[model samples]
Target: MTVLSYADSALSLLPPVVAILLAIFTRRVLLSLGLGILIGALLLNQWSVLDTGVYLGQRVLSLVWDDGAFNAWNLYILGFLVLLGMITALITVSGSARAFANWARQHIRNRRDAKLLTMFLGCAVFIDDYFNSLVVGSIARPLTDRYYISRSKLAYLLDSTAAPVCVISPVSSWGAYIIALIGGILTAHGFTETGHLSAFVQMIPMNFYALFALALLLCVAYMELDIGAMRKHELNARKGNLYDETKGLPPGANADLPEAETGQVHGLFLPIGVLVVATFYFMVSSGADALAAESLPFTIIGAFEKTDVGSSLFFGASIGLVVTLLLAFIQKIEAKMILKALTSGARSMLPAIYILMFAWTIAGIIGSLETGKFMASLASGNIPFALLPAVLFILAGLTAFSTGTSWGTFGIMLPIAADMAMGSHSSMMLPMLAAVLSGAVFGDHCSPISDTTILSSTGAGCHHIDHVLTQLPYAVLVAVISLGGYIVLGFTESVWLGLASSCVLFLLGLVWLKWQQPKNTNA
Candidate 1:
């Protein structure tokens, strides 16, 4: 099926809007995405039933295979998710999670301590958002639960930290991908004064939303400033109801699994340690291999740029899974019990896998509709130079929120944003680019179909929509604060002044929330 002429028009916006609104109101994520895909297909096919069906089937098939080859990246990622599920289950069955919780109980005396520790763990695991989202929640849940922190709150912590932290850290997979993109953009723009790495470093302070998001997370943790729906969830958690039982179990929560009585903290630590180390090793090795094949210099950043993230993650999870199984055997867990845990863990991941599949499908459909290009086109007209950063921020946020993929938005908007800035506001290039990064992360944080958001909910064992709803207000507040910062930077052309403005607004937000809401008893 071919895209209709109307594909580039306002009609293209209908599908995602329908999906997002439905998801928010009905809380049926898969259904919403499916309907959106169908609408997108119908639009592309001019409402022909047969063509729509054919196009939809072809799009779904393209997810796993296209161009006479298997989509190894997608398959590898799906495999990694299953393997990680098994690893999580194996560790829980080994009683390591419990042992670690028991050990933590001695050191963490209050709810604030548990929350702060969780945030710290999230920040520490900044290599990849996917790994960060899943690993942090699995490790931090038991401790947070001990302090009566809601699964929703746990999810908020994971979702907020994962992407925000990764986008800012220069050593992360996200950083590598972004740097590679920026390198090309810089070359295309004939920018000669700075290298890719240097440009990225320069933009760090200008990425107001990401920095403020992390800062907001810190305040929420230490000061107990749970705003809006989050406050409700925290209250429910304090009352010993971590989540609404009537809403059904989340993706990673297998309620029927039994735990071993004799397990140690080493059981939990070893598998996670191997997983992290192996992933890092494979990433570097894979990147190096790719670089050597291309006869490129073997720099760390170059290697990361060439790394196969999906394959590396899959291999790392496999190694970690093997170690987990061996640990179980050494602990003398029966073969039948081990087998049960394996099946249960894999089974627990099915819901998340299903959601991810639908998300990927609809994202592809949206791409075909050229929704992002259409959105980017809006900013092409003559506009004042001083407002460029703020405009790019809003446009980037809209594109990502519609498409549910920050990387896709980056690909579409970065070039346009860079070109716009370089053409007139050359000095504002870094600020505009930073605005795009900040806005994309904010949109990714808010989108119901975003993979990071889904993984965060899965990791924390909270209902996905609950995580979406609870995190929305917090994300919006930061976006608002960042928008103001971009505006200030656009006018003043001073990164520090812009950053100072955001910091002030953020602190003022915290103080206002503190004064307006009653403090939690635990706080």
Candidate 2:
């Protein structure tokens, strides 16, 4: 592990700020990230322009070889992506995806039902964001397309549900990771008896952003609430175009692949079913192995705490791929054709893989510069305890947004938030903890470089920047409401009051947007 020095200087904040601004302005994510990395290198090398170039070159090479490529986590994610891509390709080639879409279309009457089903599926696959995004998008894309839903809207639904649902679900990979983090922080701070799980449960109601995001999803889907760039995309979809023409087809367009002579819904359902079952099996078994020495009554949550999520996902995906290939052969797909489909599917995922690698590299560079610590330092000084929750919420969001990694932000903020609550406002610990988690998700949702954001676009087959642009307005609205909720909670310390107030605010905001829709349409 690389030990980062905590520097309380404004320079530490430059990389991510530069990266975000450039991405928004230029709409070139790769170039923006590269420039951010270059700036970080220059700062680290004491502003020597010549050395900065050499340092950036060497760092990029090392990252590709040593860090990004060779890291076990990265390799696991790559394997999962490749296998998932292959599975998706095989399904499409076998016409299984089309078959499933046709079957679904028979049951789904119109756009509203299609959107509802998509949301339901997204919410159902809450084990991991990666799995949720890929699976939901793959299965629902055809249905949404058949109903004239924009790819941007589909991407928004996928992206919104994945992280938000996982963060709130108790028996998920996210919950396990968060509980472990909480446990460690409590232990370190001499609060071992606090019951991390209990605290987590208590914090759920105060997870305003997750709640609001999910609520807004339903409002957007059922109410057909379209605003900003999303409205334009929706209007275009209604006109028979699924995406912005200027933005072009998403990477890994399957236009060239020939559909099978016969499409079978079972071909799609069976493989996905096997994948889901296998994932849970692997999660439980791996988790159990890690908790073998524990006392009697081994709980599911306990197993989850010890689960190696990356390995389990890779294991399940590999199994799912094998099963899919066998099914293809059983359906009399030629060996040569199967190979082609698999290769094509895996090839399609390369763009997303590239984005993930660069995102990881930039995250690492920003971490080395101690950007989190610099942000944390800003929380110093005597402030009213009633205002701390809102303050921490904003600070956590800023950190996660800049780094484009919620897990990283959690590590930086959780400990500090815990310490603050313990020292000053002991009674408000759960709310503060919830604020941190909520803020982290809020920031991650809005960040273009976030892994979930990238996967959402990939899964929905939408241009990445378009997904980012269309989703930003919704994310910002929820975040604004969440901040207000935290402030209310900070003062009243009433979870019910805070939650109710946020919900009301969200509804009012929706009404305002709906009222403005006519003006937007006219203009």
Candidate 3:
């Protein structure tokens, strides 16, 4: 079969299924991505005989490299990780994290406040979800543990909010790429009128996935609707069957907690502050381009037309790291110890980074195979057009869940869905698109093997499996509500109706969960 035809056979379902299967069997999402990508590339290459793998690799690499924006995001993520690693090192070696923990331990009397603080700090680092995860996870790991909040749950919050929040915020790294993608797509399809600003602005409200994901995260965090696998896994997913993995309360877990240095919390705030100032400055200055808003006068930045969030963040984090290292040097902190903490943190990120490279390669394969078009073709135009919005949302949701990327889901869905919307339900186009985006995010927000989920797990010091297990139910809860809202929006043509339906669904789910629990159980 032709690549596109086979793509018609399997694209959305295959990628995610492959990812899930790999992660479950091998405990490695990257390897699965590699395999999936290889299959995609091979399909794209028409399964050429005699040295097909070699031919496929060359073609796929060439195609991916042909587009600069596509390639930059991967490197951008990698470079961004450096700052996160350094900041982690800086915080640890400088004893700032230790001091903060001590301060919080003594001052904070309320557990709810502490949980909210974790979520608040997570919101504070809105520039990049990846950045948010690494920084927040490392910082809040201890704080969450102290309050008896499970690491799995903490990771869930961090991961859930990271990508969804970044995508929603214009200043975040994610927003930049999606904007660029949208601009290109709109311009290519003659959809852009007068420089694409209006089109982009219109897309924001339609981004249902981002909005609902944020709502879902808030629901999980403060509302504490820890039902389903959340309550079950939180109770069980501990290491070695002897420890609580979600809460990190297993024996010997805290044995590694630093003596006095772990108790230090000075200079930790500096890195965080720099991140905020730099992010705000860049976001405001760039106006709309992800990189255009930064105000970097030094380090070869003055020569550039635009300053990327990745570059700005990396720079700010570097300064924070240097300041931290200096603090460590000025004090009697052991250099070996400092280096070890950094090395450990860096080591911890390897799996995530590896998975990303593979994810990119796999996503590339799917793109090369024209998977989006194939999936687009699969839509049954004969079906009631009213169902399109809801179906699109569901498709987008599944795509995001499968690929673990909302943007990928959007990229594949938006054009065709938009075309369908424009042709059949002209007025509902904007809301329809929003539903697609919303569905994409809903899937990504909850998926166990998604990069964001992985980072959240890493951030919260929650075992990867634990986070996935705990977070899945919340994602489903929100999704079910969102689906009902999409149905209302499609049929009623009223945005308010869809929104109201989703709210009702959410409240109903929460109430049902509460009612289903055993009476007089421990809070």
TM-score of each: 0.98, 0.94, 0.81
lDDT of 3 by residue, 1-523 (tens): 2444355566435654676677666645556666666666555556665445775556456533654445554555666665566556556556677677668888877556666787788887876776788777767766766666666677777877687677666555566556665566556656645354455466665565566667766655655556765766444433223225333432112224243353356566666666667655654454435333454343222222244555555655666566667766666677777777666556555655665566556655555555555555666457688778788878777666666667677777877776787678666766776777677777787665566776676566555655666677777777787788878878888887778887788778778877766564343
Question: Model 3 TM-score?
Answer: 0.81
Pairs in steric clash, model 2: none
Sort all candidates by TM-score, best to worst: 1, 2, 3
- Provide the overall lDDT of each model, using Cα atoms, as 2-decimal numbers: 0.89, 0.85, 0.63
lDDT of 1 by residue, 102-184 (tens): 99899898889998999999999988899899988888988888888999999999988899999988788899899999989
**1 or 3, which is superior by lDDT?**
1
What TM value does model 1 have? 0.98
Clashing pairs in 1: none
Better of 1 and 3 by TM-score: 1
lDDT of 2 by residue, 435-479 (tens): 999999998998887888988998898888889999999999999
Candidate No. with top lDDT? 1
How many clashing residue pairs, candidate 1? Answer: 0
Could you tally the backbone clashes for each prediction? 0, 0, 21
